[model samples]
Target chain A: MTDTALHTNSRSPGVIVLRWGLFLILGLFALFYLMPLFVMLTTSLKSLEEIRTGSLVALPREVTFEAWRTAWSGACTGIQCEGLRPYFWNSVILAIPAVAISTILGAMNGYVIAQWKFKGANFVFSLLLFGCFIPFQVVLLPMARMLGLLGIAGTIPGLIFVHVIYGLGFTTLFFRNYYVTIPAELVKAAKVDGAGFFRIFWSIFLPLSLPIIVVTIIWQFTQIWNDFLFGVSFSQAGTQPVTVALNNIVNSTTGVKEYNVDMAAAIIAALPTLLVYVVAGKYFIRGLTAGSVKG
Target chain B: MAPILDIKNLYKSYGTVEILKDINVAIEPGDFLVLVGPSGCGKSTLLNCIAGLEPITSGSIAIGGKDMTHVSPKDRDIAMVFQSYALYPTMSVAKNITFGMKVRGVDQETQDRKLKEVAHQLQITDYLNRRPGQLSGGQRQRVAMGRALVRDPKLFLFDEPLSNLDAKLRVEMRAEIKKLHHNLGATMVYVTHDQIEAMTLATKIVVLKGGIVQQIGSPSEIYNRPANLFVADFMGSPAMNLIPAKTKRNGTGMLIEIERAGGEIITLHDHHTESLPENVIIGVRPEDIAEAGFRAGEDVQEAECLVDMVEHAGADTYVVSHLGGRNVTARLHAETSAHPGEALKLAFDLSKVSYFAPDTGERLN
Candidate 1:
């Protein structure tokens, strides 16, 4: 019955026109959002002289890989003659460990808070949740002092520590809400089946956490990779992240500004987060909305 | 041998409000003990207390001659099937069934062998590779049972396990569970608010109300002789008819007078009348009252009642009539021509009647 209704609806001229109209509106929005990426790609492919003379919206007259090469290997950022290669690796190193540590810690915290009821559990959860609302700037002074006291000041590990500590609140919030939707009876059943604390979590909860794990990884990865304040404040000369390096290359004062390199560096700095969204964006939405409706 | 399960002086309370009070219950090995009650009656709470999922306020729970009051649930040596079936959604049927064994570090050969045995026993071998989400509700229920069955624990706890299935599936699973119990003869504790499930599945039944145990007896004893007004009203499909009547002294026995809604009085003689109260409630099962012509036995008293309505159930017809200022239903043969606005003679079996003091709702005789 529904199939016939759908078939008849599709055959109507007004329905076809309305559908095409909807597509046209969506196409316009897509073009509007893609305009900046198009301009950046075209600008990165053009020579400096062509860029100075040509329109910003025009396609590249001659596509070239020169800007990408220079941005990755040879472009100078501040006093460094090398390019974003080392700093890109630094960001990768920092974000992987940061995302991993925070996600695992958050999963355990969420498991305890959601499943293991103890005295003052709700209070502790509320306190941890309160951390998510604290602005990043509010914690900079105290965090820097703590990092200095720990003797890892201006180091990559110090930056990692900062990200994990700061990102834990969001990760815990995500995981706890998601885990709350799982029936408490599963834990009870496992308990009766002779499964202990770690056994139940590892054998039961962890395997079921795939969607939320993806969500936490994406969220923490993007937040840490794109971070500028922590990277600029907590890093030494060699440990600067890709975002800081990109900023330096774009804002350097001693030489002629290479617009192509600047655009290429910007896109390079953003490629990880963009690729993450493209690959796992579906689960991000699904995991976010998972526990919204009570099952 | 010691009783398989024992509870003494169990009390569960949350802060100030008490949930369970001074509960004492024990069952021998292989007894199918069912805790049946209405919602908020603490049946589920008592089940959890037994499973060690919830701590008791003050009590000692011993299972298989071992003290388990303070022991953790994993160390309590019990298995439970939840109302929602609580299958690990991410695991296949095989993994779900063998998870407990794998956790205890059982060898692969034993785990696989036990998994195969339980899967086949529950008739879910074909769905061993399927995730719980892929199967239907009844299939998931079977897998839940399989998960518990593989453990072969000393005590099995089921909390309304069949309540989640549809009506037909619930009936089928009910029979299956009964068959499993009969075949295995395993000591089990089941909790449910459905009295029918309790009647059909339990060898021993505990009826609870408002966090207190009302009565504990066999199914026949609970059906034939309820301890109080609550049990008489709670059990049975059509519910027992409770009629307020007046009592007077006779030669040695007593004379019970029940006034109908139209002010017609019917008197009955009781054999045991020592210390009988002036006012009392008479409890009788619906099937005990039958058409006058169809029933002829000792201690039977016949009375003509104004039929209010007639419900034609397939095997038996229910005749609702006015008696003692209340609606009394009598189960009669389906071919009877009893109808509304007409008088029908119903024979009340006095031998099976129960008398309770009207004030306390406690059984008098």
Candidate 2:
């Protein structure tokens, strides 16, 4: 191995040192970033006594599934002992519909803004982009009043609506930037081939949109699933999302603080997003850079 | 029969910016009409207007004796091949060819049969199952053509279809397209900025500049008797040389006087004497000038000039010399031995020369 390394090492000493220096810096940064996640995983697997007595970075002496079970079914959140299972399901119901609806709307909006342009299309798009910049707190009061007027102020449907409304700005921006990279000639060719607006979108634009669709779905899924602001403000106790329930469980002032249960619950709330990143993480970068590069 | 396509006084504008003005074109059946111009000359704009892709600010368009000024592109019965070969990227070759038919609700059997026929004709049968991204540039161009061919529309439009191919492929595809036009005998309206393509493929050429039509004529007529200076200079390779001269009556005929280097004046008798302009520009093609003693005739005039440069192009050697204080190029036979900085006698074919008014650039005779 040493002889092979010597044979293959044709680069000069200065370049080799620079390369190793870069890897060293990047390796240190990655370790720093992974430290908190490592602690969270080990802490969730340990007992409350071990968490209090052991070093924060040490691996668990005896791994157990009790904290996971307790976090899933037995932990208390403000007057109920039922754990994060119900709120986890609430997040599921809220996120799925919100992601699907907002993504479809964003695709349509992108198609119109990119291809079927009209007189005030730029003005309208600029107005839509402004939604991405505004502070979420500024809209809380009006959104609350509007939800009350709609008679769904503290319901799961209201929370879904809130997430979809807020998510459109980002989804549209992603899709618009992506679709803009497609040549306008394709749309023209489709038009000459007898495809109308909806037909073109369904046949031509939709099939080529898989990359951007993945981008939008992942973005909206993560944003809505982890959202605590609207989840807490727009929904009442029964329909509160996982993020709000997890917050209540960890910060409750009644009993001894169960750091193990809190860590397990936090990991549970974050599991879906983590799984998505691990599974489709390669597609995430690919989709974000889809139209920016040309063949 | 009436013309297959007719555009009458068409005008297109975007707010205050006029993109095309007073455009008039009439294409007969089986005629290959080419719109040739420089970039931003509204050639592509006119083609899009005919295809109903762009709404005209004024005037009307008629195809197959039907007024279609406001008709949608699909209903207008026209097929277009874009410069980019805009095949549906997600679709296979077969699907790309049949997409229009499928959208028009053609039966499945008919779509399959048409797709097969077009695929076979374009020699893309092997690539039927492959998507456009998997194909090379030439294969993709064939697929684009197949998509247009399957429709059998009233008119065929090509928007710089060969501009994206490599030079060798462009030449091959150019010949193939010409042969296809010949075999189909279909009316085609082609747009390109290539003068060679226009000269070789067009039955009628419309030259445009800055959103206005300059002239419309056959390739030979446009090459031989261009209506204005822009057409003359824009239509040929290496360009025709325009030499400034003065014409006056000498005995009962007109004599044109041209000044050379070292203040020497040379006189040539003009064939047309009546109403000749006082100050004129003489336009001579490079082929009309030859090395002296090679094709000497009674009408040819000889002039002694210093050869500035010699370029050998295998078939012909181009010799550049000073005439009227401007570098004038002359095409000589390949066998001619010409060298720079040497005084060589060259013959001018006066019988074929054209005289134009210097001020207006209009042909005088």
Candidate 3:
């Protein structure tokens, strides 16, 4: 008789029961975590009167988008009635270039450190890693002075420069760890194939970097987009990001509380990061584990 | 004729830890030289030094009669196949083959022509659009060879290229590489730890041990006349047996004596003109020791030995016995009908044996 015939095909009843029980617990935790988002959505669809009269968790009886419209175009933020439209565009501009520049620099730094290693490569990598640990509050004053000396203080470009510099450490760390998993022979082969440093990085390394690229984009976009401290400290009124604007709209004490508008504005500020995660969430998980195994 | 590749007194080290010491070797234009040794014997390091991948600490390398001591690998007019098959995981088989040309700014027409030629030559035209990750191990190996063949460089380097393949595939690829070398007449240097590979594929074999060259010769020369104990022991399957023997001058020849475990001393005679040392090592290959009367030679000597084990390997049967306090293996005909614990008469081909000085492991006479 074959050894395969001796194996049992069915799992035990206790094991099946235990598996279902574990899934039930996981479902309950998922619902618990999503309760806040459900409340926010329901509240955003209610009128001011309905929001005040109705319970927080109850579905809105008369749905309206008036709160959303006001939050996007007409709400008052720090004595300005221009709302989050301009600031939303500012965050987009800030995040796109900052994510792009930092990610490119990170991949190059990673390639050099991982493959074309020079003397003191480990030292340079450790120094960059040390940068990831420094608190953002510690670098704010010196960064402000540096921005002033560069003569672009309180501008969108200044903010972009700040973000790129600050985000570089994490981006570089991500890329270096991922690139190290690639065999060193690939670089040697490319070098023997008459490819210079930049050419190899462009044609060979960059194409293999999709998973880590998605990972870095999601990480950098979220960090730069939701950054309230850098946004508040480094920007003028016109250059403020949506996080700072959202804060201003939520904290204003000039009139009766508008919970519905505040809720709608907070969701709008968070929508881009949420959308990015939704679109590339699978790749984000894949990229995280990609470096652990070799091909 | 001037040799195509000349390496003069090359040395490589890492912070005083020498990996290769005074490596000097050369081959003619169409010679297939193989660097062979056990792992960590600096065979791969020597190959890397020739390809200009690793910088040498001292001495010079000349390829095609031109000094290339400081040239980069790409400009050295050489192509290499890595052991891992390093076929650029992100590229299609076609792009992987043509990427080198693309980087050097070759015209697209030439790139397409070369790619098609190599793809057809390697019989990988159908897999041109498939990425390396999608291909099997043998297919990836073919693509790697295709990548090197497309260059048509003056020199080719292979760093244990067949070590990653299965045993069956390794044999197949070994034949293919030999055929490629024959057809192209390319000056190629291959490094491998497999002695059989060195024997089968190399026009010239260099045996290395502990960062030093042990011997350099043709396969028959290496097999029949090993320069040292290491080469004799390393180059053959069921390796050459070096038995401790006592020798003395006897008229026009030397008389040898080997003491067995049971106080029995087996004596043999050899034609040697020089006075011999009191103790010397007698080297005999497994095939040289056979059934009595199996080998016909004037120098054939017979001895009775108790068989310790018998392994039937289809074409030849390996019989194990004790000689001079060491386990010695002898290859006999397949239908010998030998059994364990039985005494058998074995013939030693004295003419084919080698003599080594017992002190320094160096060849004697």
Candidate 4:
């Protein structure tokens, strides 16, 4: 892909003009997504006095790192002033296991639904698309009761299991479409060689399905990591994920508004997924193309 | 070697439709058998049934004198090469070759030796560390072959293993497979739709149509003595030409009289007079017909034809002509000067002519 840009300092006159035209459009779109993050970062660096005195877009009257230090260490999160660090740790514990289990089961389920057949595999698949449509709130009460009966309610395991269950439908669907595009004969060759179900999966399908796994891991990590409803509903106060803790700090009505610290906390909460996107950006598009377009 | 595999009245069906009907064959320990037919002829289905990848609705399959009708694919002790060259995409070429050995709990020493030998034969030693996705089509095909070769099972099955290759590669692999068979002397059943592959690879060729066996014989037998009209037409390139001719038996021979387009006629020499029918159809191969200029007048054994088209194929020229209100193709020597919109007398190869019953399509002795 040539990077078409509007007029640049090139010897060719008309070609540079056309190139510059395309670059002008592309640069505008890039700035569209980056502007908000820029504003938030700049606001997080402003002192409280500068924030009250100067406009939001104005440069900080006094530069300081106090807002970040306060957000990380001292700002109160529901009567606790440990700021967002503990909540960030809490989110890590919940997100990692949930993402791992969902991605693994999703790959296996997708592979089996696509390649192997037993009865009701179609039913299993239709149930996935079915879950994709229904909003998460519809299942919240029933899931809460189910977790309470299991006696692990308000625990990390409970939250992780809930994410896996809810995430299974979409993740499996993503994986099924991905694996279905793969040649079924590869799986059959393994079976004729006396490989059982899990053996063929681990050795053949799962390995070839790495791209989709990356996509699945990234998608579910963002979804589970930032999920507020399930984290707060299924978990007690101590086990609440970072999203819930962040919500308590930023949405508090009683305290005087500290927009600088609030913006910093929000950025901190979003950093893991945003960093992942930036690093694996090329892979994300490649994986989607491999899964959907080819299929 | 005595016969090691036998299929007796094997039948398969999907719901209400029959896919394979009464497929029966027997092969010796070192015999190479080929199942061949047009697409949807159920040749692949029959091989799948034998490998126990599919169930047979009737009949039994036996290997090494043991019944394996309901056996699973693994328990049958058979190795199969799928058409798609289904290599494990995640495993290295080395791991793919050793996978079967690993599952069977083979000692690592023996596993290493067999893997090395098969890989060397397939010429994939340099790529032993790469995954299947990283290899070319021909290279992946070799790995698939190695996966099966490493197993050393009692029977080997190949399902159109070269169909995915280019024409040149297909020919190369065809010769390689034949050479491999010579070295191993293993019992193998291979399926392919290519007529040339069937002719070159099989010790016995089974031609199938509409899910039924049309003929089963050696390559020469299939070409020279087809069992019926369908078998005769299906096996040959450009197909055999058939003409309606009147038959008359005298002594030990029969005469066939054919009428040409412009009311000119010719009488064929009667070769087989034993039990000849009055209404007979004469069959001749295009290669058997030769272009000869008319000799003014000859009532005995020459066909006058108007040349319609000329197809030059380097070694010989094929002239398609209109004779007896039907198209007849004649093969001419490269030196034989003939052109379109001309008339000539084409002589049929007397020794190669065959007769068939008009109504039944069966060979008439």
Task: Tell me how each candidate scores on DockQ against the true complex.
Answer: 0.80, 0.89, 0.82, 0.62
What TM-score describes the B chain of model 2?
A: 0.97
lDDT of 4 by residue, B147-189 (tens): 9999998889999999999999899999999999999998899
Candidate 1 interface RMSD value: 0.8
lDDT of 3 by residue, A1-295 (tens): 4555543334467778899999999999999999999999999999989877878899999999998999999999877898789899999999999999999999999888998889999999999999999999999999999999999899999999999988889999999999898888898899889998898899888988999999999999999999999999999989999999999999983768988899999999999999999999999999999898655
Off by over 4 Å in 4: A1-22, A25-29, A253-255, A292-295, B120-137, B249-252, B274-278, B291-300, B358-360
Candidate with maximal DockQ: 2
Report the C-alpha lDDT of model 1 over B1-365, residue by residue, as the tens digit.
79999999999998898999988999999999999999999999999999999999998999999999999988888999999999998888899899899888999999989988888899998989999999999999999999989999999999999998899999999999999999999999999999999999999999999889999999999998899999999999999999999999988788889998774798888766656789999998999999897778767889888899999999999999877888899999989989899998889888898888888999998
Q: List the residue pairs that clash in candidate 3.
A: none
- Flag regions of model 1 displaced more than 4 Å: A1-18, A292-295
Considering only chain A, what is the TM-score of each predicted structure? 0.94, 0.93, 0.94, 0.90
**Each model's fraction of native contacts:** 0.90, 0.90, 0.88, 0.74
| Cα lDDT, model 2, residue A13 | 88
Instruction: Tell me the tens digit of each residue's lDDT in model 2 across B147-240.
Output: 9999998899999999999999999999999999998898999999999999999999999998999999999988888887888889887788
**CAPRI category for model 2:** high
Better of 2 and 3 by DockQ: 2
Report the Cα interface RMSD of each model, rounded to 1 decimal: 0.8, 0.4, 0.7, 1.1
